[model samples]
Target: MPNLYFCIPKNDAVYFDEHEVTHMKVMRIKEGEIIDATDGNGGKYKVIVKEIGKNEAHGNVLNYEFVAPTDGRLVLFAPSGRWERLRWTIEKAVELGVDEIYVFNNEHASRHYDDKQEKLELIVREASKQCVRYHFPSIRSIEFLDIFSIAPESTYILDFKGRKIPKRISKSVGIIAGPEGGFSKKEIKLLKERFKSVCLGKKILRFETAVILSTGIFAMKLGKI
Candidate 1:
């Protein structure tokens, strides 16, 4: 497979952003080298590097292809936790083909990752490139109760007391994984009232583990994995 990078396409050319320019430098990509890049909106390009500057790289678009987005979106609702664990969850979630990721603050959330949207988006972009994904996932923070408005019927809450994940999910769905501290009774009651609850198995999982596990399960059910 060709190495993938992110780019901004001009009329007949593509420009690598500063971050990607830095990546190019680290990879020692030279002029005249052919590379693959994505616009992150389904457009993938085959480009020939023409110039490498201190802050940018310019390429001529040799070929372009548009990949249609996949069916049945998989959205993840994960609770705030330690930055390292949360970062891992985000990376794996993107690799697992999640369409959107929302970090929520709940009663039992151990830590608040406030004002980390930029970092989160960077992670999403890097993960997308790593996986050669033509379409990139969106990431943001949200209030815990705000989830109900974003596809309630298809959303599932991960909890030890919930039912086993079904063989298949027929529509776009969201999976919610609680914080490391677990859910409080009131929050659990509210969640139970709004979303279907599903369990990975009998054993309880850590916040990041549950997020990845439930995401993988949902991705498989949606035919993404």
Candidate 2:
């Protein structure tokens, strides 16, 4: 089996930059070796390695293909938290096939997420390659609490206090996972009006874990898992 690698674009061409070039040379992938390439947005191309150099590699395009992107109907609302957990959530959520992951500042969040946007993007890239997923999940900057008002989709809140358990999704879904200490009463009330309050279960779950598990359940319900 060919060892697969992922590449992000620096430009639109057959050539890949320094980092991927190093991998190609180190792995001894010679000219004419069949390699698969993905553009990380549902695009996959089959190419033949034509030239290898110290800092770059060029491939001859053989064929191209793409998977229809998972629609943007599902949006994950991840409350800000520790870097490790945040990265883990992003990776797992991508692998699980969430359409979008939205990190947001919350009342009980312990850490700040202003920085590290680049690092998170890298994690998503690696995770996509590792899981052999064609479409890269969208990761965006942290939004504010009031931002919820702008979304007109069916928002599902993963809280124990939720009155409804989601069984099916007919339209776009906005899933909100609260911070470590959970959402405040005021915040919960604010969200309740914007989203249909739903519970994952009777038991409590950690921030990252809740996002993944609840997403999985929703996916299964929607027949997307």
TM-score, per-candidate, Cα-based: 0.93, 0.84
Residues 121-140, model 1: lDDT tens digits: 89999999998889999898
lDDT of each: 0.86, 0.72
> Candidate 1, after superposition: displacement of residue 173 in Å?
0.8
> Which number leads on TM-score?
1
lDDT of 1: 0.86
Instruction: Please give, for residues 1-225, the per-residue lDDT of candidate 2 as tens digits.
Output: 245556544434467667667667768788889888777777787878877778888786677777786544667777778778888888888777777777888777787666878777777777877787788777776755645753537777787777656556666777887777777788878887777777766776666667777887776665455
| lDDT accuracy of residue 81 in candidate 1 | 80
Q: Pick the candidate with the highest lDDT.
A: 1
Worst 10 residues of 1 by lDDT: 144-153
RMSD vs true structure, all candidates = 1.8, 2.9
